[model samples]
Target: MQQLLAVAIRDILPNKVRLAITRLCFFFNAICSKVLDPVKFDDLENEAVIILCQLEMYFPPAFFDIMVHLIVHLVREIKCCGPVYLRWMYPVERYMKILKGYTKNLHRPEASIVERYIAEEAVEFCSEYIKKAKPVGLPESRHDDRVGGKGSRGLHVITPSVEDLLQAHLYVLNNSNEVLPYIVQHQHLVKQSNPKMSKNWVLKNHNKTFSDWFKDKIFADENVSETLRKLAHGPKRNVITWQGYDINKYSFYTKPMLTVNSKHIR
Candidate 1:
């Protein structure tokens, strides 16, 4: 019931973009999701061009909005900016709703908001000083032990963490395709180091940390390593270079034309 209400409110909101632009954004998001390496730049560019073409096709005849012009330069914007979220207002707007809820009194709304905010901050500060007190504004069930229990429908599967991936043998077996021959040679090296170790034991223990212990270990190319290193660090910032309108460009000056037949007009 709660989820349905939330969905209805979200759908009914006046914040929606045009259907064509929404579809284009969805495609762009799909491309971004699969970008694990720098090699996917060509694919990203192609998707961006498709979106620009879509914007041109679905452009309204009467409206010459700034957003439409921005859509045309989406590719350049993405190149300058990191991702869509950084440039999007959805998160900011959602937070604004929370801020709006802070207002209580009609006569002195600003004072009420400030008072509520200070009270919240004081409670949070007090929670830190109190022994074993749950953090203010957090639900009592937030850290409940029964969260992922048998009857609970919560997600229970635990994927390997970054530290685990750096130290796990199973990760190497699954991702060894990138450096297959090197992995095989590394297995031999592991065996030499611990001849009595069982295959299961070796598989669970061999990792990048173990590789570092070996004097001669197979490593990825410096460029590939650097690219992977950057991927691990994640996007830095959401900076976009706003494209300026060229006065001479056909799209900038020309308005969509509508023709009426004389016989139909009469």
Candidate 2:
């Protein structure tokens, strides 16, 4: 069963980073399930293996939860785009909420450890990751009461403290990264094309305030109510990445995003 699972994983994982994550997940699950039959999931390079092992020690099951949270978004999209019956087979939204709450709580301790590691090591891994990452445009910018001006294209840098970073990750688990992939990977087409309006689109669309949107659209689930409350009351500009793979926003400096130059990136 484990061998078959490994084979399937190799087929699905599209890159080195995803492969590293797969191997780490495989290791964690194998250790927990006591699968000791000489599995060959350790085909990762030396550096990748070391990083995965470090992540395992630094995060344990918490890292797995974070990875699961990111993957859930993709899985949800797949279901949404599939047949109606297939959509019912996966409780994507409800599972996402559960994973969000779980991942947020998991990182509480790790953020503290990350904070300490960054301070002691004097490495700005978080900043480095952010610098390397191509910025994504905000989706459907609306006028902000706080700024009292029309929003323009720019990076939304939300700086958070160590504890706040942990909380942010939890909050973001529910908010999928719809803009990043579109903007970063396919910039020309998006810029040239005027996107067709959806059949369900509305101009004034019974406009809901932030609180209104939170209550009606977002906050029906009671499982994450406490966390949501914290988020509602807390700051948003800079926080830890709970759900998304964008590591730049995370509080830790040691676990930066692995970047290669566009020329070198394969």
Candidate 3:
């Protein structure tokens, strides 16, 4: 259902309708994650309600009745006791199905369940007492032939290719523009150490060489000024709070502004 809604909003639906509905669903999912504080929850609830009402006004009444009721109640429930998962019946429903599967005799299901459960528990307890004993229902030899050797674990480790290493190094350099001068100095030092070293070799080992040189610079306190420059520059805010109003020319106008603090903006 979540994936369907996401696909509809992101790909299928038009932007005018999709933007509003997507924002509402995004907040709903965020609330479900149970990470939001009271202030943030309140903000989300307000935005959700506004968006829901706008959607109801634009769409047919029949389309919203049940959904609106559920959304309102969900918001209220979240406000009262955090996320929905805390009070949801999904885990209980799963366990109930498991218990139902254990029944043998439909007429005397309770008795059958109790007997089977007790016998299973006893067998499990006894199995634990035996050294290197496998579980009761499992096969005696459970070796996974797909993994090749008997002792080999079925784990695939990924190693980055030379091109991947080069790309990663370039990405770091591009983002951290301040590191260029230091890299140039390091290259000069490398050239002095190995006069015959080719530019191709330096390019290939750029990431490793830069990392080693950077570490040395830190330990020797050579780039204290550069470090301080980096420390002084704070992280940029990615979020913008917008206030919408009706204009004469434009039906709706939204003015974007930065929030006072990160806590107030999602």
Candidate 4:
């Protein structure tokens, strides 16, 4: 709840108030996350006290209940025992609720629970030998394929416009680390030729002409890396577009999918 609220709150709240909320959420989230280290928990425990003080300044006195105080002790309790989910009462409460449902007769509730439980146990035991039986599990989601950035999908080839192709090819070169030296060298040449040019003017000149300049440079030099040589030649005008591309464990959709409500992307 705090995590979700923090994002929306940042847009609306004053700077100090937003910082308070963001820090509070981080402290709570860090405490509950799976791995526990005493050293980190100790730091979080200290931060918890500061967060409560921040909350106290913003919230009314009535808000400081025993429940709120328990936030500080959470880290200590986890250190003494294990993770909260392993020891919480929620699981026990759920089982008790299930047992209550087996009581069809109010007058003989205990007998009903015992009889139902034994029958359930017997059925489970017998079902183990049934070869055709399938274990019930979570159903497959339709968006499963759209979940990663492994590669491009739904490839459609098109001859892109010259201006768009040049811009895209320039963007690729600008971002690629291997091409950084060539970029710096080209920028130096642009600056040297136009000695009085402003930095922005030099950048504009570089972006406009660097593709051809780099291609010529690559052709003249024989010692350059193959990667740089391929980049110098530039991407084909006939490029492949994707409806979906999976990268960094996320599926991204092209703009056309957004307009038509893509089934693979939510």
Candidate 5:
């Protein structure tokens, strides 16, 4: 609608309903920002008042309730207090949502909420001293902060096959910094030896023999990280697999879990 009305509506004050909403949205975003300018507090409040006025033009009188009127005061609060994030309703609303979910006794909602809140707080406090216990909600893996992350939940240990172990070992070696120069040296020599070999063949050949070559070549030197030395030594057959993983704010699931979720959706 904004695109359609773009040519017809020239004034900054939105004539179209959708344009008014867009204007309000932009204004709302500016006020909600973490680092708001105190100098622009008046302008921000004025802008909000204008947006609310514009909204009144588009919406009904009933829509201009107390909640809608509250938008006009947000900038003043920010000016007196600090950033909106520090004083936002989001945390309280989310906590209230959790409390609402605790309503087993619908008639005695206050009682239920108080009881659950106390129990939850008690559990949270006790959890700190309860070593090796899974948390009541959102269980954290001790390995979550480990190098390269250790998945959020449902980690299973298994013994992998020799081929799998070899592939895993070579993969680690290929990506190692200390061993990279050796790999380049090996690749150069391989290329010199087999001039007719394709780039793919060179890579394949390098991968096939680089592990054993590096193990021998690197043992003479003892300056690399213990991790690099271990990678050179090769992985054992045993492995730990994750059903779900959280790495760098991204969540990954195993194929079976994905399949099950898809089936359930279908």
Candidate 6:
């Protein structure tokens, strides 16, 4: 399939679209091998068609518009047995990530719409899981002037609720299915590293209350969020850091993904 796309892309006029065509072919090839059958091919084909149509819109004179529409229709011909076959395990998110990378690389005129659409779709997908899971009740505001700071009112310092935990869990699960196994294997490290810090530390040591700890430890940590974002993109290798932290490089779970690298490539 990749070879076929590589050849077809060569014929696409406008060097930028041609390059995008080539990369997208490779991206699809990587994803198609993993998706559940039947629905997988059709959805992937449809996605490819959408991208091609975007390209055609940019370069209509190349007759790529007809090719784009034909490809879109071909997607309907592929038959699948189950709905799961249509649903992507991680490919949808990964595809959007790749599109972002591709658009950045190409610097094309019409790529922003495609990039924005893909990113928005990814967020929508994440929101679905958020809706399904309960929110983790992390502290939002502090109360004491000494601990909470100037003019704060909220009384109790709340910790991340179950929803926040679940959101983090599902985000990791859907994005890097492989990381689960690794996380499971090293759950000990995660438990130690992510020990539920006491509110006292935030109040006395940091001059803030438990509420501050909740917000700072869970929600306000930019590094942790960035790490989650990376994990959401793809399966990453669990690189053991020198700091004696043997946690899953991507997720903070006890189990790791089942053949994380292979599952990702497939």
1-266: candidate 6 lDDT, tens digit per residue = 66697886686567777776776676456454545455456557657666775666566565655545565544454443333336645778887676665455355625775776778799999998686565589643223123222311222323555555445544545345444443343444334554686644422432212222333344444655565444434332232222111222221223335766321211
TM-score of each: 0.35, 0.15, 0.46, 0.46, 0.50, 0.22
Which prediction has the highest lDDT against the true structure?
4
Residue-wise C-alpha lDDT for candidate 4, range 153-222, written one tens digit per residue: 6778889799988999999999999888889999999999999989999999999999999899898999
lDDT tens digits, residues 1-266, model 2? 43456566676655665556566565445433433332333332233446456555545585566654443243234333632233353578786554454343454856755565556456576667676565589453233223332223232454757555444543453353432332233333333342564423322221112233444433565665465555444355553322222222222222334584321211
Q: What's the lDDT for all of these models?
A: 0.53, 0.43, 0.63, 0.83, 0.76, 0.49
Q: After aligning candidate 2 to the native by TM-score, how far in Å is the CA of 155 from where it should be?
A: 18
The true-versus-predicted C-alpha distance at residue 2 of model 3, in Å, is 4.0
Instruction: Summing lDDT over every window of 10 consecutive residues in candidate 6, give the lowest-scoring window.
Output: 243-252
Q: Residues 207-229, candidate 1, lDDT per residue (tens digit)?
A: 54344432133233344554343
Please, what are the lDDT tens digits per residue for candidate 3 over residues 1-266? 54358666688777767877777777667767756677776777687777787787667878877757677566678877767768879899998887787799999999888888888889988877884754688665434233332222222334556656545655665466576777788777777777788987766566556664565665676446765344323222332223332223222333344674322211
- Model 3, residue 261: distance off in Å is 64
> In terms of lDDT, which candidate is stronger, 1 or 6?
1
Off by over 4 Å in 4: 1-156, 242-266
Instruction: Show model 3 residue runs off by greater than 4 Å.
Output: 1-4, 57-68, 104-116, 131-190, 193-198, 202-266
**Which residue pairs in candidate 1 collide?**
none
Which lDDT tens digits does candidate 5 get at residues 59-172?
989888899899889888877787877776888999889989988998999999899989999998887778566668775755554557546667789897878888888777
lDDT at 147, model 6: 29
After TM-score superposition, what is the CA distance of residue 158 in candidate 5 from its true location, in Å?
Answer: 13
> In candidate 6, which residue ranges exceed 4 Å CA deviation?
1-15, 27-36, 39-42, 65-67, 80-266
Local lDDT at 152 for model 3: 22
